[model samples]
Target: MPRAKRKRASSENSTEPAAKAGDKEVEKTVTSGAITPKNKSAQKTGEPEEYAHWLLKSEPESRMDKGIDMKFGIEDLKSQPNQTACWDGVRNYQARNFMRKMKTGQKAFFYHSNCKEPGVAGVVEIVKEAYTDHTQFDPKNPHYDSSSSRDNPRWFMVDVQFVRMLNRFIPLAELKQIHLKHKASGGPLKNMALFTRARLSVQPLTQEEFDFIVSLEDVKA
Candidate 1:
């Protein structure tokens, strides 16, 4: 069974649940990836809906993951593993569009880069809509820039709320295993965009890819 996670108040800088209000819900949209809002909405409804998928990269060595932030003159973030952090620092235009296009409830694959066993680590959701990336305005921050004004922001970002952490690492080796097996049967292994384009930083996953990923058991003892 999936563990029940506690939703924290937004004021505490935690990820709040999606607003279910009909008026507030923005139309589901995907501006960058191949998936389109119209198709995704149809999928949401009874009309043969297609799944919209995306891949997000985070460096475990960096302060991106709240779980490993003890060395930053702060307490261990292990207790609050599901804390939602602002995903900023994206400079690429394609990446920024993906961030801007992300809609609430969109599923994302959290991949840990710059790590020994870099691969899909867990799942996350776009709980909040895209907004201006604040880091671009901060001069002290490495991601800061003098060109981006408040009125004309150069970057954008989305809020990702942690869903659940897989018990075991979904190693890249395992993904390769699946590919080889599929290829042997004359099946297409092209579903995984991550494998084809290593430096995309931001990419979409198809519904088929999303289902195959979730189907992997954690293999807990």
Candidate 2:
């Protein structure tokens, strides 16, 4: 992706009080205007524009209503089977950060984990931006926490709508092959969140990689 343009700020008005790790201090920083390639001739000749993609991990059974049984519960399922749902239940800070970064319309890979066949099973679209995850406030909920107060909640979630299930499971091993191929082709999968141990759920995907993965379901199936 092209770096955003930066602009210099006048010294007289540049200083401002900034918060750092719980302390306030005066810091001088430059203000930059939105940056992008100024001239097409100077831009990379064959680069696709950046579009965000995400992978959302869920233990399908946990998400379903109690007493309902299925490979995955219907109540937990996206209403249209292609509709979006607020991806609540995340308790980790890093996962919350990724959710906060996601914008509406961003794509997500729905990965079913801790199940019989853990893999990318379907596609979803971000339908809502990050918001306080209400489940965290419910004292009876398993995700509830004494540390998370209404005034200073520590958890967040975003809405994701279902797209379509892959015709066949995109197995973990298959994803590895796709990841390697993407790396060789100089794509975003080279630095994918799925490859990072700390980020097992709610990951970003590039548009190119999204198309590539979906295409696999159509080949000679």
Candidate 3:
């Protein structure tokens, strides 16, 4: 497989006030958005529900953002109070749109990026759906955008709680190889956004792709 040049993972800086532990906020109606999920009833039903999967990227190594360390890997999330933190600092409109579609209880792969062995290290569940990202309003924050405002916030974030780490780290190189094989074999991961839209910080995953990757942890390399 040809190695595609890896771009730096989209920078994330979350200085927003943390929400109280175990507080699940009410889902607000998305009045305007093209990607809003068609089946919102799943969010209301108090039963086991199928959720859309996602892959989120963050740098695990030390990187400075306005004097603040932007290194947030699965371990950083594990050590956080209540094992939950705001997924903020996403400035890309497309990525922000993807965040908007996230629902509470949905699972996502916590991918380590811009590091020596970038890959899916763990999983996280959305504890809170998309809300206004306060960092964009702070002038001192590295992600602060003057154009964004309190009334009509231009950026948004979701709160995720740490789940378990993968049984083994599945490096990006391995994933790329699988992607190429799947593409040639007409498999589920052929159109995985991680390759198709590699630059996006937040990428959507099909259920097949998510389950298939998680199943890989048990297979010996």
Candidate 4:
């Protein structure tokens, strides 16, 4: 049990927008932010609840932002247990292949990197998708993954729900000044993988950059 160099979770979160829950607007796109199908009358009843849109980073504190343990923000995923949780100790492999291309109910944007005043602090859905993150085969897990195996598992987890908690917290220096004034908007978000994968904790958003960062919490609520 040795090989450990994976320690980059707890990104950041603040929390406010929380009302959208149903009426499936059926949108699902990944393979690195590629989602377009949403017309045919909202995909004829949301094509079996297909969904896609993500950005997950947590760290309301997390042992002073990565000193160790804690690993959950947005008010600990709205006091988990049932608000749902298990975006386990990711052992990055491009953020575990973007959580194996999540696809339960899609929609995510709970950013909150490092601490103090990061950005985005709301939205979540992916109600269970990938699995097998048994704390990387716990040997007193700090995401123990001594070369994972139970027949070759490396690390994975997905199961978010807590939809809505925003009250006002979008910061990341005001979305990097709106990503330097729409860095040449070629369809918006001009290559915004959360500012070039800032430590990539499962990022991928392009429903027009997740509706322009959830429409800045609805024009600041």
Among all windows of ten consecutive residues in candidate 1, which has the lowest summed lDDT? 7-16
Q: Give the best candidate by lDDT.
A: 3
Residue range 1-221, candidate 2, lDDT tens digits: 11111100000101111112111111111011111366342154332233387777665443233332222322255543345455666655545555777778777787766455556788777777888777678775555667788998767777666667778767666776666887788664665556643233555566766777778777652
Backbone clash tally for model 2?
Answer: 8
Candidate closest to the true structure, highest TM-score: 3
> TM-score for all predictions?
0.65, 0.65, 0.79, 0.33
Greater-lDDT candidate between 1 and 3 = 3
Q: Give the distance in Å from residue 55's predicted Cα in candidate 4 to where it truly belongs.
A: 1.2
Ranking by lDDT: 3, 4, 1, 2
lDDT of 4 by residue, 1-221 (tens): 11112233523333322212111221122232322375454356332223368888766654632245654666776775566776777655656656777888887988777667777888988877787777678776555767678898866778777799666778888787778778866546656767765656677676777887776776853
Q: Model 2 Cα RMSD, Å?
A: 13.4
Q: Candidate 2, 143: how far from true, in Å?
A: 0.8
RMSD of each: 11.0, 13.4, 10.5, 13.5
Q: Can you give the lDDT of residue 124 in candidate 2?
A: 72
- Over the full model, what C-alpha lDDT does candidate 3 score relative to the true structure? 0.73
